[model samples]
Target: MKRLVITLMLIFSSIIFSQSNYEILPIKQHLNDIYIIRMLEGENIGLYSIIDSKGNLLTQTDNILISVQKNHIYLVTKDYKEGLMTTDGKWIAKIGEYNFKEKYSNMYKEAENNSEKEFFIVYINEMPRHKYGYINYKGELQIPIIYDEAENFSEGLAAVKLNNKWGYIDTEGNVKIGFNFDEAYDFKNDLALVRIDDTSFYIDKNGQKKLMKSLFREGKEKIENLGYHIGSAFEGKLKIKEKTN
Candidate 1:
């Protein structure tokens, strides 16, 4: 009986040692010729490391979860917050500073352009109230987290809501449109639809109301003409006409 117990202890010890041994697998290859490796072990199951084709470690991280997006590697923490990193494991932004959660479907979308810097929407959890802001790839706060709600960038601007009113803000966080509309939609083809008091009308980039050439007119005339009101904009056109019997 003593011999059997000692054998069982030895087998358990070997199993623990094997589980603790690190196993590496190549997960993604970046355009910069660096490879992102996923390391699995008893203690560090979700850890990531940067490596070369020859399996040489460039950098290792145990806290931040790595995701490959385009030419960049995004670092996400356990709390669902995100940051940007280079292929060589250098940080473009520190993890958890920005609250952007990467979507698997849109992960490989074109991010940056030569004309404008790439920006991401970040969410801040402030207990009873949650706010959103914008951050560039450099981790600079382009927009402060003062908005109660926000939409992604469209046509160089984004729709934000504050105090129950929707407005538009440029990439630099400047208010290009006043916060007077009850509802606003993203701009497309230099035009957007906004609603005030129950009437919906199209607006230019400069916030000037554009007369809809469609059957629907503007203001009271629009309501009287269509026997209903325009609801919202869709793909550069206002298609939310009310159902009139």
Candidate 2:
């Protein structure tokens, strides 16, 4: 009887040991110092952890997807919600809070270029209502999810639509450009093309309209030179006639 009890205890110990032994797979390496560790085994299977090069655990998470972008880490939960965290395992923001998707366009490029200020667009999809907002790299909701549509930051400002009117907002969620245009485009060359009713015109960063006479002259010259009307004045490309010897 004593021998049987000892055998049962040994079997239980072996089972616990086997279950506790987890297989570590390196998924991503950041800054040559932090490693994104995916541990497979035991109760924390499918979970992720961060460790330094010397194997010191920095943080552990149950997020489904963990991605590194510059100094910040993006966390995606199993339920499709997204958030951000720091490399040292600090929760800049908790996961599974908001529905955020990566905007993979010029907006994303603009955000990538401005590494000093981290910002991301938050998208909310609901039946009969779709909204957008902005969140900083630290996972703080900088802009409330209330806009009908929102563009990525360009030239330190983002174009957003509210009640069918488009305007621009700064990084701090301040309205740099008032909501007055029927439509608006991203800023380029310190100016943005906006439409009021059917008339489209260019506006400077201060929301002042630029004189269209020079732009119209350039557009007409391009149309006559190229033999094709290029839609809008801003869409028109000037064709320089080469000087003949």
Candidate 3:
């Protein structure tokens, strides 16, 4: 009986040792059967590979892997060009001009769930002068690189800067809100906060004032919770006696 127990313990140890050899990465970045795996033991530890459901090697490439979307694989070539590939290792399309954001990291893992816009933001030229624009999933430029500053789309609108003024634009690049504000922010709950000259207030989708007594009271309560009065919270941008109709 003692011998049998010792033998069973040895077998269990062996099973654990073998199972610890590899690590299955995040599933959101992979298809149903395809997965990104990394070696956790032996000399090849830390090495990554693309494998099938049955652990069969699919294909190997030195290009930096970005993310998988639908049937296409996004990758960055050795020469810094961004492109796509098939699951069976065939080239789809390569674009050289725009450098994709997070080229070396895992990007777009949950992009499908977090965004409604099909376009992603990209920048051109160097810092302090990098013009911003949007691109489709197929590496096609949708919006021209013209904005001095840009933010991601929220509720079908993105806040962008032009001629040193901020405004909102739709996914089609049409100015939804006129460029007249000194600062702007993304929309949330059908309202966006904007500032003109020294006054800060909230606006609706049509660029109309949306500050009601309820919103003002809510802001005051939140500011007080943070140990700040509403007058100081807006830094003189909000008037103390501003009537809310």
Candidate 4:
């Protein structure tokens, strides 16, 4: 049991970014390079790269930004504006209308798996009204650009905010579970951990609580079958105690 748990943990860590029904977001720069984000604990945008570039890394931005397909780097201004530059310090995609006065932005520091013949750097747009969304490898809005907040993909589902509440959404941008929780976690064993009224519980992708079926459906049947007398608790516990029909 311990070994099984350890294996699952390792798999989860490996594909933490491969969100949704085990969907793998395949992105690579070239034949032998794998684009990956290696952010160490404590740093905001730590070590974004295409594996080992043989010291030919394209380091161009101050705040985690990269476009492997275009081979460009972007820097955001102190007041939340984007500035684009190349790996060797050349202006390619300049920051202007879209970046000016933008409240939310999603920045990509490096590609994933380094196989992306095409890629994009996202801006969170963190604005309450904007709530920036994600883009596909083709730079298309796979998910609607509208959301209060969006999390990384996990198990083909993502935590999205709508109407000031949170819920889960499939890759098609359809709501799977009702968005009415104070907090939510990734899916595990086909169940998602949700918090309600100071209590934490697990619910299936369909929003059914795991223990609900057993507690409500089976608890009563089991009680009746036992003749409504749960005497097992006292059985053999006391020296003089005896059980009767």
Candidate 5:
């Protein structure tokens, strides 16, 4: 009886031990190779320099925090916000915070023809009405922030909401695409996925809807969440999952 109890306890302990899980993803800077890192335990996660494919933690655990693009986990942020930070720890932008929505919709103006326009979030001191505009990446309010909301730039265009309508605008702040569309998404690759009424369609870089789904750029591939989503197209492969007996 004593032997049976001890055996069961040992088996349970072994099962728990084997279930302990962690993930390591590869990192890179442009064509330069960085280190692989992962977020573990709590809010604090740093990119460790251990190069073993098995994710060994080495001496330089102070490098990068990762975001998986494909199988390669690119360094996107190191801050607790886990927002984007340069190697020198500068705030470039926060991922997933670029979208602008209201009680109505997520819309914007089109990019101006043959012009350079940028996306911006207009900060207002009071409620509603035209106010100061701020640009993303490029820090110049070329266009006044007269609109209620605005979003980031993709494929040289952004979506802005004004007078309770949506329109597309070039980075130059010109109304290349008028205030239209009930809702829209930032461009990925070369197409922006948009939803108007009850229909969803893919728009080209020029903001023209592509009726043929095949002609449309394939949907942006989601990196494996098990390991991490690396930046850029996946070069390395990682299978992040639990081992089943």
Candidate 6:
């Protein structure tokens, strides 16, 4: 019985050893030139390293590495900010420039595969004011950071806020729709919702008002039926004059 137990122990140790050492993982779908090697036993345990097709180490190490098709490598920095790195170990977009923590993946998901005009939304959260713009996969700033607020591209257009008013701009940074609404939303089914003077309605791609799906239908009905309260902090700041006999 003692001999059998010793043999079993030896087999278990060997199995663990085999599973922990430098193991080459499966090649990524589009990134056929690089392979991911995982080190499960040494000091770099739980980390991944990028290697060329010929087994040459490209990146020193990565906490997490994701292949965003078309040879773009996504990596998270030591400080938790995300950036794009080349397979040969070069930074496409410097770390900490944009806080793309959870937004990096979503950007590529919406991108058109291999489209040269593709742009991803980028923003800075530092002092002064937070501004938004667009950037290509190569980290080139296609649009200047001038907008107060911006949304992702939809139907080749994006809703942006300038001077406290919302409008739509094409991928080329040209104003496709004039800035006139107080609030604007993304386009879906060739229509978008916009609000002005506390009234909300849907508009088409041409900025023409469409008579469907009023945003404040319920609120308007209530106001028309029972009237509205004013002056009270919970109600609003507007004051109403009381009738005197």
lDDT per residue (tens digit) for residues 109-162 in model 3: 544543223566777776678788887655577788899888888998999999
lDDT of 5 by residue, 116-233 (tens): 2233354544464544354444334456667666776777777777776667777677786666677777877887777668666777766687777633433322224423545322
Better of 2 and 6 by lDDT: 2
Tens-digit lDDT track of model 2 for 54-165: 5666554455666665556676655556766665556676665666656222211222533533777777786587899988876788998989988888898889999899
lDDT-sorted candidate list, best first: 2, 3, 6, 1, 4, 5
Angstrom error of the Cα, residue 157, model 6: value is: 0.5
What digit string (tens of lDDT, one per residue) describes model 6 on residues 129-179?
Answer: 778888776778878787888887889789999989999999889998999
Residue range with the least summed lDDT across 10 consecutive positions in model 1: 105-114
Residue 90 deviation, candidate 6, in Å?
8.2
State the lDDT of candidate 4 residue by residue for 1-245, as single tens digits.
99999999998875564222121124333223323343343334353332223323233223344443335443454344565444444444445423422122323333433331222324444544555465554335566667766665567777777776778988777889988887778876687777766656678888888897435545666678686355654454553454332
TM-score of each model, paired residue for residue = 0.64, 0.63, 0.58, 0.43, 0.38, 0.61
Give the Å shift of residue 131 in candidate 5.
5.3
For the record, the alpha-carbon RMSD of candidate 3 to the native fold, in angstroms, is 12.1
lDDT of each: 0.68, 0.70, 0.70, 0.52, 0.48, 0.69
Please give me the total number of clashing residue pairs in predicted model 5: 28
Instruction: Give model 2's clash tally.
Output: 0
Candidate 5 wrong stretches, greater than 4 Å:
1-120, 128-132, 136-139, 214-245
Q: List the residue pairs that clash in candidate 6.
A: none
The global Cα lDDT (0 to 1) of model 2 is 0.70
Error of 1 at 94 (Å): 1.2
Error of 4 at 217 (Å): 21
lDDT value, residue 175 of candidate 6: 97
Rank the models by TM-score, top first. Answer: 1, 2, 6, 3, 4, 5
> What is the C-alpha local distance difference test score of candidate 3?
0.70
